[model samples]
Target: MPFLTDPVLTAGAFAAVPQPEIPTGDGLLLRPWQASDAPAVYAAFQDPLMHRWQLRAADSAHEVRGWIEEWRGEWATARSVQWAVVDAGEGALLGRVALHHIDLVDGVGEIGYWTVPAARGEGVAARGTSALARWALDEAGFGRLELTHALGNGASCRVAAKCGFALEGTKRSAVLYTDGRQDVHLHARVRGD
Candidate 1:
């Protein structure tokens, strides 16, 4: 397939991104979200910290299920691929990770993740994030991956660094939260980096 010398950025024909079960080292696995996990997802999202950084809000199990369905829709449209990070040993949902803002033509995407309260301080986010990054860059053929976090989020910054994302800089008032606009730090990793 070839594009004209100057082509407009259209949605263009896109194949669905694969969503296979990925095994993360140390007994962790990344898999597609299931409707049965709605209650757990809702519980995780109830955390104040999660609400502070992430814009998603699901007050009930029904809403959480809808959000999971939305994730599947996004995946089918080639817009995003989200995975549920689980503990293989316990079969417990530990977190969620996603490769979104997918630009197939440009070979780029952005990563986002959050760990449940019980999974925090256990390296769940870092491990799951790194695993997804490898898959996105190598298997998915993405050339570059970007991760941005609120400047006040130290844990996210540390996770990004651990996953080999270099801190590019801060974007002033880049994110508008419910309270007010907040600055965000941009971190990036290239395919060969």
Candidate 2:
């Protein structure tokens, strides 16, 4: 009862995805974003660096709260998994890492991250990214994950490298920044790699 071109596939339901708390190196915790963390999220997005790369900007804590709620929806739909990077002792929101563009059937996803200005230069992005990417590939049953950054963003390039993601190639004018279009470097890691 199947078409000749149809490939046999495993069944998956996005609504059944579970969110787990992940611990990272150097006393950092990766967990679901809380309503209370909206203020910190808003503050981090205000950074100049974030503005230069990311397209959306939150103007207030309320908007960030909405963003967090949307992330919860994404989790429920198996569309994406987002984690709030926080300090172990203080529970201070340090950054965020996410596996977006998730395809449950294909077992593939894309990784993205941003660190607060205060947490920059401390390997926070690298550590959190590694933890999240590993979790996606190992525990989450993903076969491949990709991370991309603007070619001019050296810091993000370093983070990807530190997490063992190999440079695949350049995507010409793939990203549109506020200023103009920019070439992006595509980095990826397969489950075994």
Give the top-scoring candidate (TM-score).
2
Q: In candidate 1, which residue pairs clash? A: none
Q: Candidate 2 residues 70-155, lDDT tens each?
A: 98777777677798999988999999999988776678788999989999998989999989888887876778899999999999
**All models: lDDT?**
0.87, 0.87
TM-scores of the candidates in the order shown: 0.91, 0.92
Error of 1 at 192 (Å): 1.5
Question: At residue 121, what lDDT does model 1 achieve?
Answer: 100
**Residue ranges of candidate 2 with Cα displaced over 4 Å:** 1-14
Mind giving the per-residue lDDT tens digits that candidate 1 earns over 1-193?
8765432222533343356788887789999888888999999889999889888788799988998888866766777889999999888999999988887768778999999999999999999999999887777677899999998999999999999999999999998987899999999999888
